[model samples]
Target: MGVQFGSFDSICETAALVICSLVGTAQGIEPSCYSRNVEVGGTIIFQPSTSFVHIVAIIMTAIMIFHIRSKYTAVGRKEIVMFFYMYIVIELLAMFLDSNIIPTANSSYPWFAAIYTGLVAAAYCCLLINGFVGFQFAEDGTPLSLWFMRIACLVVFGVSFFISIATFKGFAGFSYSKPIGLWIIYILWPIICAAVYVVSQLVLVFRTLEDRWPLGDIIFGAAFYTVGNVLLFAFSVTICDAIKHYIDGLFFFTLCMLLSVMMVYKYWDSITREDLEFSVGSKAAVWEVKDPLLSTGLDYSEEDTVSNYHGGGVAPSLVGGVSGQQLYQKGGMGGRGYPPSDRY
Candidate 1:
């Protein structure tokens, strides 16, 4: 399924941003004033490349939540959302503590630093779990309910949480500056790996046209996110850290813009899950339509057989819940819209 686990909703992102803003203000989390040297009276306001990853984190989370609740609307979706929500909390809270927003050197809890690392690890685990969930969705907008998938998600979350706590408390915490655990989390077995996996799965589906999955806004967003993070990671590995602090906000801001825009103008994603039942030729010769106001995924494949309900005055749009008369056949050549009446 395209949208996180199909559409990007922004409610949670908005709420989290407001809460973080208030907290940052109260705690005096001074955003770096990169514009002070360039702009008049810039010292009084925030910079263009803001150091507020939490703001965008929540917004992205909100879109995932909205997609789960509205389109998927399944028990599995609820479970995935719950984990995803936890992931958001961990990341936002870490940003609040780890940043110079508040000095951690003389903090009451000597172990707080480890806690921050744990949060990062756990959050990545949640992200990977959601990625796995995305693969389970059937064409009909429900997950496969596969036990192995469910078990894998649970096991990873559980193990990741414990390992994160352990790594933080152990000697790894002090040497975190050149940390192996952190390196593994970000490099060898990076969180972005999940995004890569998703894109790979999508590519496979497109080529075979055997799976009915929506290539909704989430795919594009994930692709964008993966690219940004990959570039950032590569640069961090090779380059100096002096400029990263000042410009890191740009990467986060760019991701937020891409995702937010896709959420608003979701043309391809507008088509309902019903559309996935219809056939889309193939990746090489794929033909997709655009109707911006009607943004949601119309998942399809070359081998699909679409069946629609054609009755009453309520005509179904090619992409459902839209206002138009495109005269699409309710059901294709070999399909029937309704069952025969049991008059006998």
Candidate 2:
């Protein structure tokens, strides 16, 4: 029975592939350009320009992680940091994949592609989840919020990975030749996630915040993300041909994506202020200002102390020559180190 079911599934996949190919052709869908190769010191590199951009992006993401860590008391610091970490992983894998470090004919190529697809989906999911972190729905940075984002992104990755692998290997009724599932996961899923994230963040900045600078960051992020997709999917071949194979849309796509990610960090940082008292790495500076009115009626003369002492032991005046500045330097006078309200 299992054999029969497998055969039936195979037949269905083949039919689906045929139908999808016809539909795709009718819709004018075609493969994007393959970036040009380069030779440096007799060593060949595939997608050289895009790969270099990916490396730079990875480094930038690492720096972003450091910046995020320094926030220390941002509302969603831990939660958003996860997104950048995943982005770094995706960029590293992209560098490997685009450079043909793992060639298409390699046995592990499909697995790498599957993992890349999954990480992309998970990253977008993380972005979407982060948009809601501002709403205090589950208390950002708490165990509940942090764990929920982690588990949800993990689930997204698993689902995306399974779909991508199944399609690549032509199992579970998924067809590599058609790859409708891949289109859904890779193309439509990101679009959905991005749209939702943008909308949510817009609402947050417009309705919830007093300052509107974050709105600009959000808009710039959306613009960069959109341009990246448009260049990659629509103009890659044209750009490659126009550039004489020296570069391609993939380079611009990667650069734009990096800018988009930076905008995400900018927007997050704009909305969340670091609490200096609890922040790491440096002590916050504190300034003490003496109020002129605080010493309006105070007397520190020894004569006053002796006079008050003779009159049934009233509280002694502050010792003479003990200036208000000296008292302040000594950290005030009361047991709790604050001056009495009636005195200086």
Candidate 3:
């Protein structure tokens, strides 16, 4: 949740920065006043306070790569692979755009903004795919709520893609700024994704509790992610434009670090621990005894057996032997014959 929130806040901060810059530019005022200026080899660039966002993004990409490589199962491995490839492609695109490697009409440098926007759309698409696969493989296997979330992500990805394409095609036009559409992409999409993640976590928590499984790791991890994202959102909304970018970057970087650490710690024992076993219902009983004692003998009738035992006139002793003295003292057994030795 923290990561989601942080990412959201970071995106919001980026949006706000871009909007402020656009508004300042429109008003014939310098947007650099709200940004930090840096000189690289005599060339000037306005470095937004949110530059740290890129740094954090790099760290997150690394962590995701590690996660993908470390994961063991086929599902986990596939998830990691998808995430890794998608993130790497997106990151590379972003770098190319940021570095201005592509040439533009006004400057000999490349139009990195168009490339960056396209990469963002691609990244979101990958995220959507990952979420879909994850929901499918979940223990419940496609619950209604999960299906809804998956569809919502897909719709968001589609919208983002169209917007990116428009921005890329109209790169030279004044109205081609993708930042305007990004307002929706960065602000709304993160919130939706975070909500889905939280709901999924809740489901897992309840399921684990029902099964009497340890939930400490899942609970803690989810709580961290959730809280981080919430803080990022709140900070982005409240901070002044001058400082919002820096704050946003800080929040994102911190969240990524924390999540990476927690995930590593939580899964460290995965190799040594027993594989989790999930069953739909109750287990069958297993009897160990080879033979069980029964009161009835084979081919015997209860009534007949009782009558035979009584008709023999066998005097009941203290321990199932004949005892004439005791039988006589109690009452004659209807003058039944008994040997002298039976007196004892």
- Model 2 segments more than 4 A misplaced: 1-33, 40-43, 283-344
Tell how far residue 150 is off in model 1, in angstroms.
Answer: 7.2
| Residue-level lDDT for 235 in candidate 1 | 39
Please provide TM-scores, in order, for all candidate models, with all chains considered together.
Answer: 0.45, 0.75, 0.46
User: Residues 100-196, candidate 1, lDDT per residue (tens digit)?
Assistant: 3433334432244444444445544544544444344542223444444446555655544444444434453423222344335423454465555
Q: Ranking under TM-score, best-scoring first?
A: 2, 3, 1
Model 3 agreement with the true structure over 1-344: per-residue lDDT tens digits: 23242122334333232222222122211221233345667654343233444445567667666654553432434433543455555555543333333322333222344344444544444444443343345532235434544455456556665564444344433233334564456456544654564455446446533542334554565566566655444454443354643344334434453563344334322312322343222357565654545433445444454343546444456664656554554445655444434585
Cα RMSD for candidate 2?
12.5
Instruction: Show the lowest summed lDDT stretch of 10 residues, model 1.
Output: 3-12
Ranking by lDDT: 2, 3, 1
Displacement of residue 136 (Cα, Å) in model 1 is: 4.6
- Residue 320 deviation, candidate 3, in Å? 53
Candidate 1 Cα lDDT to native: 0.42
Which is the leading candidate under lDDT? Answer: 2
lDDT of each: 0.42, 0.75, 0.43
